[model samples]
Target chain A: MNNRDPENSPVIRLSDICFSYPGGPEVLDHLHLNVYPGERIGILAPNGSGKTTLFHIIMGLLFPQAGTIEIFGEPVRTEKDFRDVRKNIGLLFQDADDQLFSPTVLEDVAFGPLNMGKAKQEALAISRQTLSFLGLSGFEDRITFKLSGGEKKLVSLATVLAMSPRVLLLDEPLTGLDQDTQGKLVSILSEIDLTYMMISHDIDFLEATAEKIYTMKDGKIMVDEGLYIHRHKHAHMLGNMPHRHE
Target chain B: MLDEPFASGNSVIHRLDPRFRVMAAIVYSFVVAIVYRFPALGLALGASLTMIGLAGLAPGRVFYRLLLVNGFVALFWVILPLTAGGEIVYQLGPLDIQKRGIVLAAQITLKSNAILMALIALTATMSFATLGHAMNQLKFPEKLVYLLLLTYRYIFVIEQEYKKILRAIKIRGFSPGTSLHCYKTYAYVIGMLFVRASARAERVYQAMRCRGFAGKFYSLAEFDSSRRNYVFTALMTLTAAGILYLEYLPK
Candidate 1:
């Protein structure tokens, strides 16, 4: 199941992508990346390094100034062309509040399936199943805003999972989550079989879930495999410390 | 954090269908608003109080809400007796109180309280989500229902953002004052909030589009059709008729 075989075409390909905001300097300059099927890719970047902008470009929310964007081996340029791309790609936003707009957990989770023209009963069934899969079976009627931070993060992931997307684009999925919830999410991500590109700053989390990690700098990704430092006891200024290098 | 304080309950009113409860609240409020006779007003108020008891809401919270409403009503009690033209009832040095003004103010107090209590008992017993779905089921305009649901969803986010901005300023030893600098800083804070809110709104829209959201908001909430719904309708109808009879009894 090695998806990195050069013979197999990429599921997503961005070539010579250049983009900038109006009256601002370029955010992404000649960026290039390829995502293969069933490959879990992790991206590490500093704050304001256009990590989110890259995902937005892939989803066609923001068009690149110059680039050839291809999804599933087909070129995408307009909003009409991206409809299929959006349907097949599940994106988890950085802020769970922005992602979960419905008042209740069930409604938010069912939104994607319903938008795909699922019948009322079928969409509800899908929502329930997804929530249960995420260990949130009894939270169907809970108010979205009243949920704790960890619960809201899990529910937001459930909303994305209910879509049954072929590819996932996760932006800072564990930024503000608790340790227990982070462990829960890591296990869940490991169990799910899907092609995904995750943007995160937590090297330990990326090491646990992603097969390959790349760092983004100056609007382009650099393969940084050697950056993953193995966990070992090390001495610090005061005494012997058991901390991993950043 | 603003949460629904009264939505969680196991009382009879809480178990009734939200759609029917909404309709009942509308009809009862309209009836109470038009009935000016003391007997009818008294019956309406009693019915509202009974509804509150049936809902099983905490008396303390209910009284707090009433206090908030009566705080405004107290102003009417003070102004109407002095300014409204009517037969003089009392004189204090340079002031004359009128009997008609006192009666008018009393009518308003009763009417306002009755409507507010009935609304709390009927509609506020359900979560806002259920209420929104009930509105959709009852043929409320689709755009309006979406507006209600979206506003409910984002208001907390906006409030959190406002708090964060306030915290960022407070850590810098910022304090409130009547100086021009304070006013200017407050204006900048509001402006920044709007800017961040619009940015978040754009991101939310993009997220919705990513989930394949079309113009329609599909609701998974279902209203239960049970014996209780019918019972509620019958009870509300009887009360409305009784109040109507009381209103015209003397005639």
Candidate 2:
């Protein structure tokens, strides 16, 4: 079925998605999510809350037991369908080690473009440009395994961005990053004009980046329209009243 | 911590085309392995050491590697002289050191050290990525080359994961002992590492697929064989031939 539509269609639409690992509890049960163009969506949840499962289902890495996933209004069911979908969707794995498999930073960034049928020289050019864009110009020959954590994370993002995907799926992009690097990343990400759905527990970061916040709980999602600040009624010391620090 | 010690050097040997270096190292090692006499073995060892010097690697590191190799070769000295029966060269109480056994042990030690030195001088100077590209250009098996690349890339990550698991175990008051419980705990640690590695592999593969990786790996690395590569290859080949001639010539 030719389901191609206009560019304004929702970039990703999941309907009644249900997924369960074999012999395990259901992680995503009859969940529905819609991501529109130019939307920076954030999914916040604690460990084991199935936020990553939702991202996997959207990216076609994990197939749901019962659901229909549509990308750009095109229904996806087979590996071929996912292949087409992946051309426009980039995924940044939680572990940079998992994503950056090539020996050097340049080759790792060039991998996506090369696999997408770019010529060797063209892929190299694109990889170089992306690395420079990410402020990693001198890291072309640096070994991926030898890089610092922040550098590796930036290289991983460069690898994804080299593909020029329309939508990005970032899983815990802020984990293990220091404050300075996080601020640098935030500025870099702010300058990019792309839709991204990030899964992170950093509320301040999500608030700073995402246009909409979502909380995943018990295989369901609830929209969090307000700030995620929590208030308590009691103080740490008994018989002491809570007071704000000046 | 298993890093290639001399990989980041900026010397003549380090700058040679990796394909030529790989080919020359293999040929030199074969020549070293066949040399039995002391003179030929010494010549080969001198050449290997000279090349290592040209590579500009720290002499201390080279000696450390040589010491590591000789530690294993030291075993031959103990076993061979006692086992092989020949004309007695030295006697200590109840044991005889045979003349032929001593010669054989020396030959083995010389050959092993020469080959090890040649490899350290030639192959270890290039980064792993350069070596992989060289292998690809030499028509090495694609699957093996890809596997090597992935293994080199992820080995450190797996090591870090193993360390994390060990730290977790230690925090829980686990200590190594000869008890059955300790053995079980160690086994569980190894088993957990394997499980985590397998899961990470799966995630890595998925990430690859997400980025349009089918099965075959396409590398953007390009290597040009310059005059330096040809000169290096010729020099290594002549040295190897010289070693072979000296080893097999009639006395």
Q: What share of the true interface contacts does each candidate keep?
A: 0.98, 0.93
TM-scores for every candidate against the unseen true structure: 0.92, 0.91
lDDT of 2 at B149: 83
Q: Name the lDDT value of residue A90 in candidate 2.
A: 94
Q: Give the least accurate 10-residue stretch of model 1 chain A, judged by summed lDDT.
A: A225-234
The TM-score obtained by model 2 is 0.91
- Model 1 chain A TM-score equals 0.91
- Local accuracy of candidate 2 as per-residue lDDT tens digits, B1-251: 77887899789998888888998988888878877878889899889989988999998999899999899999999999988788898988999989988989999988998899899999889878888988988889999898898888888889999999999999999889999999999999899999999999999999999999888788676777789999888888889888888878898
Model 1: per-residue Cα lDDT over B1-251, one tens digit each:
66678999999999999999999999999999989999999999999999999999998999998999999999999999998888998998999999988999999999999999999999989988889999999999999998898988898899999999999999998999999999999999999999999998998999899999767787777777899899889999999999999998877
Worst 10 residues of 1 chain B by lDDT: B214-223
**Deviation (Å) of B60 in candidate 2:** 2.3
Candidate 1 clash total? 0
lDDT of 2 at B90: 91
Interface Cα RMSD for all candidates? Answer: 0.9, 0.8
Error of 2 at B184 (Å): 1.9
lDDT string, candidate 1, A11-116, tens digits: 9999999999999888899999988898898888899889999999999999999989999999999998897898899999998988999988998999999999
User: Quick one: best lDDT, which candidate?
Assistant: 1
